[model samples]
Target: MPAESAPVGRRERNKQQKLERIVTAAAELFSERGVDEVTTQQIADAADIGTGTLFLYAKTKGELLLLVQNSHYADALERGRAASADARTPLDGVMALATPIIECNRVQVENGRTYLREMVFGDPTEPHHAAALAIVGETEQALAETLSRLASIPAAEASALARVVSSIMFLTMASSDAEVDIAQIVEGVRTQVSAILPR
Candidate 1:
C-alpha cells in the first residue's frame, strides 16, 4: 500500500488519543493549581480515564509534569534556534537562543524550578528523567550550533561553551526566589559569551 494510503491500527490510535487526553488534562490542572496540589485521580477524572490508566501514563505527579512540559520545552528550543538566526553578534546569538526558554519557564516559574531540581537528583532509570535529559541535550546542541556559527569556532569548543552556559543559566534561574528575569539572564549570557569569544 502507498504510504499516503496506509491505515493506522485501531489500538495505536486509541493509545495515542488516550495519551493526548492525559497530557491535555494534566497541563490544565497543573497550570491552574500547581503540580504539588494535583493528584492522579483528579487528572484521570479530567482526562476521562480510569485512575489505573492515568498511572500507566505517568507513575507520579512529577512524571505527569514531564509529560506535559516536554513538548513546550521542545517548542521553546525551536523558537530559540530561529531567533538566533537574526543575531548580530555571538553574544546576541547566545541570548537569542536562551530567551525563549527563560520566557517559557516564566509561565510556570515555581514548577519550572521544581522540575530543574528533580532532574538534578531524580532517578536516571525513569522515563521522565530520560525525557528531561533528551530535551536538555537538544537545547545544548542548539546553543552549540548557534555559538559555533556566530563565533566561527570549532563545534567541539562551541559544545563545551554551550554546556557551561546551559549550566549557568539553569543554576541562575533555579536559584531565583520566584519568577526568572529574562533580561538578567540575557545580560549574564552576554558577559559569558564575550568572555569566551575572541576579542
Candidate 2:
C-alpha cells in the first residue's frame, strides 16, 4: 500500500479496536445487569475510555445495545447461511436460515426486545438504525439466494418468498409471549412457510 494509506488504515484499525472494547464491556454489563440498569459512565469506565468517547460511539443506551449486538447478529446470519447449505428442501433451508437468528435473540431477551423495538420505530437516520437494516438485508439476501438455488425459482420470486418468510420469523420472535417456547415459534414459521412455498 501507499504511504498515505498506511496511516488511514492504522487509524481505522485503532478505531475498530476501541469500538470492540466498548462493545465487549457493554455486552457483559447489559447481559449481567440488564439494559435498564447500566449507565454510560459505567460502560466507559469498563471500556477504559472517557465518557465523552463513549458518546462518540453511541448517543444513548439503546444505540449502545445495537452497537454491542450488531456483530453477534451478523455472525448468527452467517451461521444460518452456512447451515442452510446442508438443507434438503426449501422449507428446511428456510428453517436453517431462521433458527440461528432466533437463537441469537434468545441470548439477551430484554436487550433483543429493546433493539427490535428501536429498530422498528427509532430514528431512521441513526447509525444503529442503519446497522439494523444492514443485518436484516444480509439475512434476507442469504435466504433469497438459498431459496433461488434450492427451489429453482427466479431471484425476484425467491426474494419475495424470502420476505414472506422473514416477516413470519420476525413476528414469531417479536410478537410472541415471553413464556412462549422457541421451538413452538420456529414450528409456526415452518408451518407458515410450508403453506406458502411452492411444491
**Top lDDT model:** 2
TM per prediction: 0.90, 0.89
Q: Write the per-residue lDDT of candidate 1 for residues 22-64, one digit (tens) a residue.
A: 9999999989988888889999999999999888877888888
Write the residue-wise lDDT of candidate 2 on 88-182 in tens digits. 89889989988989888877677777778777777778998899988988888998998998899899999998888888888778876667777
Which 10 residues in a row give candidate 2 its minimum summed lDDT? Answer: 1-10
Root-mean-square deviation of Cα positions for candidate 2 versus the true structure, in angstroms: 2.3
Question: What C-alpha lDDT do the candidate models reach, one value each?
Answer: 0.83, 0.86
How many backbone collisions does model 2 have?
0
In model 2, which regions exceed 4 Å deviation? Answer: 1-14
The TM-score measured for candidate 1 stands at 0.90
| CA lDDT for candidate 2 | 0.86
Which residue runs does candidate 1 get wrong by more than 4 Å? 1-6
Candidate 1 Cα deviation (angstroms), residue 40: 1.6
